[model samples]
Target: MIRVVLTDIEGTTSSLSFVHDVLFPYAEEHIGEFIKNGFSDNPEIQEQLEAVAEESGVSANDLDGLIEVLQTWIREDRKETPLKMLQGMLWEQGYQSGAFRGHVYSDAAEALRSWHDRGLRLYVYSSGSVKAQKLIFGHSECGDLTPYFSGYFDTRVGLKRDPESYRNILDQIGVAPDTVLFLSDVEAELEAAETVGMRTALLVREGPLPETSRPVMRDFDEVDALLRKR
Candidate 1:
C-alpha cells in the first residue's frame, strides 16, 4: 500500500504558466534591485551569494557581477540552488504583496485534501526551494494547504533526474521505496523515482500522453481512484 504521495508542483498540482510567465518574470524584474537594496546583508542571501561565487568561480564581493550571473540564470531558467533560493526570497515578497495567489488546479486541491484526511502522508518534491514550495501552498488559491504536507524536498536533496536523489528522499522519509508514490509531469523525474524502486504516475495535463510504461493521469482525482483500486 502507498503510504506516502510525493508530488511535483509546477505542471503537476499547479499551472506551468504561473511559474514561467508570472513568477519568473517578477523575479527577473526585481532581482537586480532586490540585491542592490542592502538585502544582501541578510544571512540567507549572503550564504546563497557565497554559493553562487563558489559555483561560478567569481568573487562574492562583486555584487554587480553576481547580479548579472543571477539574472542570466533566471532568464535561462537554470535550476541552480543559489538561483532557486534567491527566487524563493523574491517570491516570498511577491506573495506577501498580493501580486498573485499561487495557482493550484481545483481537482488537485480537492484530491490533496481528501488524501490528507484519509491518513496518507503527503509530501512535495520540487526543484523550487522548500521555503518557496511552502509559500506557494500556504498562499494557494485554496488557502493554507501547507498543513497537508508531511515534508518538502528540493534540489538540495539532489537533482530530480538522479536516482540517488530519490534514494536519499526515501531514506529521509523513512519509508520503503515501494510504499511511496512519486507523481510528476516530467518523464525523467518519474523514471528516476522508479529507478529507486518507488511507484510513479505521470500527470499528463496537456497534449498526448507520452509513450511510457508508467501509469498516466490527467488529474489527482484519477490518481486517487487508481490507487484505491490497487
Candidate 2:
C-alpha cells in the first residue's frame, strides 16, 4: 500500500560520520567567512543573518557575535532554522567547490533507483534546509540523485520529532498516511510518524540498534523486503 517513501538523510540514506565528521566540520570552518562575505552576493544570506540575529538576541550589527553564535550552533548541531539555512548556504559552497561530494550509501542509491523505477514516489525530509538537502543529493558520491526524488521537506515544515510535521507532509503529498513509509534512524522520529498513522521503519546502520518496536532495517534492501510484503 505504500506509494511514497519519505526518508531521512543523515543516518538513513547516508552515514552519520559523513554528517558529524565531514559536513559539520566543513560548515564550522567556513561559516564565519561565508557570513562575512556572503551578504552582498545573495539577499538570502542577509535574510538568514537577520534571522540569526533575531533568534539569538544578538545585535544585527554585530557580525562577529552572530558568527560566533552560529559556530556554536554548528558544534551543538542545534536544529534551528537560521543555523540550518546558514549551514546550507555554506554546504552549497563546499559541494560546488569540490571540497567534498555528499556521501550516500551504495545500497541507498541502488534501492532509490529501484524504488523510483517501480513507480513509487520518493521524498526527503530532513532537519537540514531544503537547499542543503538538494545539494547533498545533487552532488552526491553516486552522481546526481536529485532526479530520483519527487520533493523535499526541511525543518521549515516542522521538526521531524513532531507528529504534526508528519501530518503536514501527509497533507501536502495528498495521500493516506498509511500509504507513506517514513524512514529514519531516530526512534522518536519514527514514533512521531506513527502517531500520524504513517508506516514507519527504523534504519540502523551502525552501533547497537535501539530497542524499537517498529521494524528495524539494516539497509535499504531490507526496506525493499518490507515494502514487498505490503
Candidate 3:
C-alpha cells in the first residue's frame, strides 16, 4: 500500500547528462561572477555562508578561501549544505537572467501529473537544495510542475545515505514507512530508505549497477507496473 512516492531528480526522474553535462557546467561557468555580483548580502546567502564557516571552523571573512573550497566541492559534487545553497543562489540568477531553464523530462512531467491526479502523495528527495528542487520544477520545460509535489527535501536534513533522513521524511509526511516508495538511481540511497522500512526501487537509466541490490527497472514504465501491483 504505497501511498507516498519520493523521487530523486538528477538521474532518476531526469537525465544524468542534463545534470552533469549541462547544469553543473552552467553553474561552474557562472558561479564566480554570480557570487561576486549577485545578492551575497541576502539573508539566506549570509546564513549559508555562516553555516559553511561553522561547519569548516573557518572564518567567514576569508572570502577567497571560501570560494576556493566551494569550487572544489562543486567538482566533487559534494552534498555539503553550503555548497548546495550557494549553487541554488547562483542558479537563481541564471534562471532569472534568461541564461537557461531547468531541464525536466517530458515523461517525468507527464507521469508526475498523472500520479498526482490519481491521489498519490509525491515528494522530492534530492541532494540538491530544496530551493534548487523548486527552481528546477518551477521553471521546467513542461512548465511549473511545483504544484505537483506535496513536499521537498534536501541534504539540509541529513545525508542521503543516512537512514535517519528517511526516518525524518517519513515522520514529516506522517505516513507508515512501508507505504512510502523511495525512487532513486543510487543504490545506497535506496538502502537507506529500506533501512527506514520504506519500499524501494532502483531507476536504472544509467545502465545496470555493478551489484543488483534490489528490484531494478529501466524506466518509469516498469515502476508504474510495480506500483500497480500494490
Badly placed stretches (over 4 Å) of model 2 are none
lDDT of 3: 0.84
10 residues in a row with least lDDT, candidate 1: 35-44
Question: Model-by-model lDDT, in order?
Answer: 0.92, 0.93, 0.84
Per-model root-mean-square deviation over C-alphas: 1.0, 0.9, 1.7
lDDT of 1 by residue, 1-230 (tens): 99999999999999999999999999999998987884546888888989999999889999989988998898898999999998998899999999988989989999899999999999999999998999999999999999899999999999999999999999999999999999999999998999989999999998987878789999998999977976
Ranking by lDDT: 2, 1, 3
RMSD of 3: 1.7
TM-score of 3: 0.93
Per-candidate total of colliding backbone pairs: 0, 0, 0
Over 4 Å off in model 3, which ranges? 38-40, 209-213
- Per-residue accuracy of model 2 over 1-230 as CA lDDT, tens digit each: 99999999999999999999999999899888888787778888888889999999999899899999999998999999989988888898888899999999999999999999999999999999999999989999999999999999998889989999998998899999989999999989999999989999999998787776789999999999999999
Question: Which tens-of-lDDT digit does each residue in 66-146 have in candidate 3?
Answer: 666777777888889888988987887777777777788787788788889989999999999998899989987789999
